[model samples]
Target chain A: MNATASLDARGKSCPLPIVLTAKALRELNAGEVLLVRANDLAFVSDIEAWCKKTGHELLGIVSESGFLEARIRKAA
Target chain B: MGVTEEALLDDPSAEPQPSGVFETELRRLSQRVAELEARQHSLARSAAQEDKITLLVFSNSLDRLLAAFTMATGAAAMGTRVSLFFTFWGTAALRRENVQTKKSLFARLFGWMLPKGSRNLPLSQLNMGGMGPLMMRRLMKQKGVASLEEMLALSRELGVNISVCSMSMDLLGFQPQEMIEYPNLTYCGVATFLERAATGKMTLFV
Candidate 1:
């Protein structure tokens, strides 16, 4: 699937990655995927929970080196 | 004579009555199961509403404000609904610019001495007159902690309610427009705050 946008929130603290991803999701049309890169230790579960609460679909999360990459699709 | 099982099964409209200890035991277990399920559902509903946090912010010092906002952010992230009541000096923390005034001499003195906004707040201790807050802000950035502004932003995004004390605003000569137009901000008195505090599972004064 093609990504509609990508947000690089690496090195940001708790809530920033989720906050930025949320902001980005607002601008994207439904069914578009967003790629979020975050290095915060809490990013994994935070993103997962955020997606669940906001009704977004967490397509997948891949861990690379010391950071994490999450792909989330906006729910229609 | 006792009813025969063959007749009970063959008759579609037959009312089969249990006459033994096993049937009584089975009935009791099913009733117990229904009772337990109701209790479980109520317990879960209470748990979900029990994570509320009420923060009474009375200090305007930089360190204290930082602590208050950090706690607000953490509690909100943990799925707790948070309500912040700003009073006295705490009201100054929410101001975007210095509130213009033409009040009494004493009121003017207090207004001049107090920090005008979130960025101008003084450190509670070891301020070295002014450098302590600056140093701590830099250190917080280096440590990857969100700044007070960032936390406040997150708090708004997470629906943390921010309210200003009306009495304090009047005493301090602050108009509502002087403070940042935070989302859903309201001006209320102590009674309103008490109502919120009474319902919250966790209440804190900072």
Candidate 2:
């Protein structure tokens, strides 16, 4: 079973949400999962674009009560 | 036709050395020269961009960029002509709406856990289950980046122009005309911002 980590980065801004997610993802080996909880509207597009450009897998995005959560898998 | 005596003596047909290798070296040298010229052009462009009044966007999460804005605005005070155009959640840092004026004794009993000034209203859409704002505050303390309210204060002290988007005003339930005056704020529309951005030499979308 692969390990998983989570980062709550809701109110943070553009570079930060991405910066922290990358930081957390860095700690995990390839094929690991990182769940990012954020409500920043820009994060949805920014992260998706980041994942696409970097070859990471953006597992999914879902709207919750006050924020959005993104599931991402570290690129193998 | 213009080949010098040295070139004639260095002729590739008479020698065993590879002409292809020499051609490759010439091509590589030309490419390297072109790359150097391109880099110089980019630097010149960047400096030129910095020389004019740049419009910066405040959409991202970290307050470091805010700090940079404050610094630039401070520099602008000595006549740099800097301006900030806030849209979306970035607008929260400029207004007093929905800011928590009260805090518990546990965080800071004598006064409050938050700043006495207007709370940099967290953008509603990116609340991060409320943790994102919390983390930013904690990290601000750890990193010594100024908090939203504090930056608001410095912005006032330094005379930085803070404009809140009128369109955002409608979406966020903020009445621009009724909003508190932070000494550095103004409520305006897209055209208002365009007037500044269009004429200014520097304009950045956050």
Candidate 3:
């Protein structure tokens, strides 16, 4: 997925990834996509729940060797 | 005339005539339901608007302070307004390290007894002569978790409001200069905390 912005949260713990995701999403315009790469396994479900609560669009998630990449579109 | 019970019993299928009083009561009941629904809607809207959490930090222990800071930072990261009101022993965590401030003997003793800052705070349980905090810090580092100092700094950076209790300060003889430098920090009494907590979605005592 092509993202307007990217955030690398590798090695960060639970809340930091989500917290930093929210913070990074704030900097982007509505409808823009934010690609986040995180090694925390919890981010898989956390990003889904966060997007549901915040009305963002979770495009998809891809799990690679160790990190998980997620693309989220900011809510309008 | 309204249909009588005896008449209805005789002819079960017969329709009863509507009375003015009964119609008036029905209209009032529907209006009341509408009013209540409107109130419920507005309450939900206000709750969404007031996405805030207030925490009363009353302990200075390393574990409790860490918990408090973690919650504050997490809530702040989620775009919620967070307020931490530090009172009594909790204010010790805000002290700056190695600051020599002139004080009376009693005040000096009080200062000496308390932890210098977040880094020096003792574990609430199983302190084991300060070894518990050391082990906990090492464990946190090994897990790649942010330390208490980092959490505190992040909380400030995330715009978490830190309110120090002025009464606690007066009682402890702690001067403002001895406190760590934090943005959005304020010195206020309990009333200020109450006011902020009142408008918040949740208030926690830590």
Candidate 4:
């Protein structure tokens, strides 16, 4: 799926990746998609809970060779 | 409609007469479901009240300050509203100057004894002649972890409310200009902090 924006947070730690993702998500219009790359192990569950708490839609997460990619859709 | 329990009880020619047991079981299950729903409703209401984290910064030691900022940033990142209330020695952590200040006799003695601001904060233990904090800072950088300064800055950027205890400021004789310039920083008393803490989901004293 096409994403409205993409962010690379592979090297960043726990809250940093989630914090930056939130910052980027806020700039997008409702229903837009944000693709995030993170290597922090906690990022997987953290992003999931973050979306659930923030009312955003987590489309999917793909674990790559060294990192994971998450696609989230902004809520309308 | 299905055969009513009243009908089954009232009828003298009912088969087996097992309606009493079935009705009791149904009543118990309905009561359980209602109890569960009520609990869910209360949880939903509490969640709707919004999440709040109150961090009481009572110590100005480097490690404690790091812990406090980490807590604030972590909470803020999770979309929880955080308030960092600096009081007592914690006020020294927010000072802008890293040097000893020449103020009143007591203020000057405090300045000479306590570390000034985030940068000058010493480790609470294993200081080893000031090398402990220095080594810790270096180690944090080597590990690619954010420094205390960076964490504090991130806390602010993440919308963590930073408040200085006005009573502590007065008692410590700190001038307004000596404190760090945080955006929309509040100088408040303990009563205000207590009110916020009472409503907060988590209240921590560090």
What fraction of the correct interface contacts does each predicted structure contain?
0.27, 0.00, 0.43, 0.27
> For residues B70-173, what per-residue lDDT tens digits would candidate 3 score against the true structure?
78888887668899999999999999988889999878988999899899999999999999999999988887678999888788778999999999988888
For model 4, the docking class works out as acceptable
| Candidate 1 lDDT tens digits, A1-76 | 8788999989987756776787788889999999999999999988988877678899999998889999999989
For all predictions, the C-alpha RMSD in Å is 6.6, 16.1, 3.9, 6.3
lDDT of 2 by residue, B1-206 (tens): 23543564578664644455567777999999999999999988756643336455555344434555644443443335667777765554444444343334442231222212234334335567656677767876665445655555555655567777877656655445435576657777788788787766767776
lDDT of 1 by residue, B1-206 (tens): 23555665567766545345447777899999999999999989767644578999999998888788877876665557899999999998988765574677766776677777888888989898889989989998986778888888888887899999999998887778778878999999989988888767888899
Q: Give the C-alpha miss distance for residue B98 in model 3, angstroms.
A: 2.3
Question: Please, what is the whole-model Cα lDDT of each candidate in the order they appear?
Answer: 0.83, 0.62, 0.88, 0.85
Q: State in Å the error of residue B36, model 1.
A: 11
Query: Per-model TM-score of chain A alone?
Result: 0.96, 0.91, 0.95, 0.97
Candidate 4 local lDDT, A21-74, one digit each (tens): 888998999999999998987988899898888889999999999999999999
Give the CAPRI class of candidate 2. Answer: incorrect
What are the runs in model 2 whose C-alpha is more than 4 Å off?
A1-76, B1-71, B77-79, B97-128, B177-180
Interface RMSD (Å), each candidate? 3.7, 11.9, 1.6, 1.9
Model 1 score (lDDT): 0.83
Task: In model 4, state the lDDT of residue B178.
Answer: 82
Per-model TM against the reference? 0.68, 0.40, 0.83, 0.78
The runs of at least 3 residues in candidate 3 whose Cα sits more than 4 Å from the true structure, single-residue gaps closed, are: B1-49
